[model samples]
Target: MEQIFKWLLTVSGGVIAFLFGAWTPMLNILVALMVIDYLSGMAAASMNGELKSRVGLMGIARKVFIFAMVAVSHLVDLLLIENKIEVGYLAMSVVITAYCLNEVLSIVENAGKMGVYVPETLTKAIAVLRSKPQKEEEKPVAPSTLEVPAVVAPNPPIVTAEVKKEEKEEIK
Candidate 1:
């Protein structure tokens, strides 16, 4: 039984290393940044009273996709090496660097949400990422849709101020 456990562990480690490629400094930084970005995001959401299980689950799924991308990049790198493509492992480096930049941006945004004054350049980058070009016909909204709009009564009462005394008496 102990030997079986040891075999399983060895296989698992081999599979992981194969999928992740060589653990370079760039990969190490990417992983650390990813973790920090995720935790900072959670903290930001919690502070804003926006934390929800579904969103958290979605975040986990996104992180899984990130690793999947890394694996795909690594596979491409392997192909390049095996075929003598002369690309020199650019795929993995590109993937890792892209994700690291993304994580850094997210961490900055999270810090901003948590009331930390980030640098102007970083805030501008966040704003650029956040902004969407609105359509020409789009309208601005009242910030909160939670406030109920006014509803009319089923039957409104008749106004009597303009009615003459004779009319009032007749109605009575």
Candidate 2:
């Protein structure tokens, strides 16, 4: 059993090394963000009483796709290197950064849905990161002009304390 476990571990390590070379800090951050996003999504769903196994499975599949794309990007980088191209993992960086930003945005949204207070500046920063530049002839809408609704809980908190206080004041 120990020998089998060791063999499995070695194979898994080999596969990961081939997929992502050296496990750079950026890749580590991307992986961390992916996990945080998924957990936050599940928390939000549970809070809203909307947890579904199908949705969770889909989320897991999407996360796997994200990593797969990252692996593909790394492979592209390797290809460029083999072709004597001077570009330094540009494709991989772009792909990973984009996915990381997306995961961050999803995490923020999930936190908001779960009634956590997220700063406006942080959300705006994410929005700016998400926006693409328009062509010279095209006009871009300012971020300030966008109307974002406030994140409110589906069920408001009961007013028991406030109502009782008001009743006491009336008696006084």
Whose TM-score is greatest here? 1
Q: Per-residue lDDT for 44-161 in model 1, tens only? A: 9999999998998999899899989999999999998999998987998899898898898899999999999998987887889879977799577777855777998989988777
Top lDDT hit = 2
Give the TM-score comparing model 1 with the true structure, all chains together.
0.72
Task: Look at candidate 1 and give me any clashing residue pairs.
Answer: none
As a whole number from 0 to 100, the lDDT of residue 51 in candidate 1 is 96
lDDT of candidates 1 onward, in order: 0.89, 0.91
Q: Please list the Cα RMSD from the true structure of every candidate, rounded to 1 decimal place.
A: 18.3, 25.7
Poorly placed runs, candidate 2 (over 4 Å): 121-172
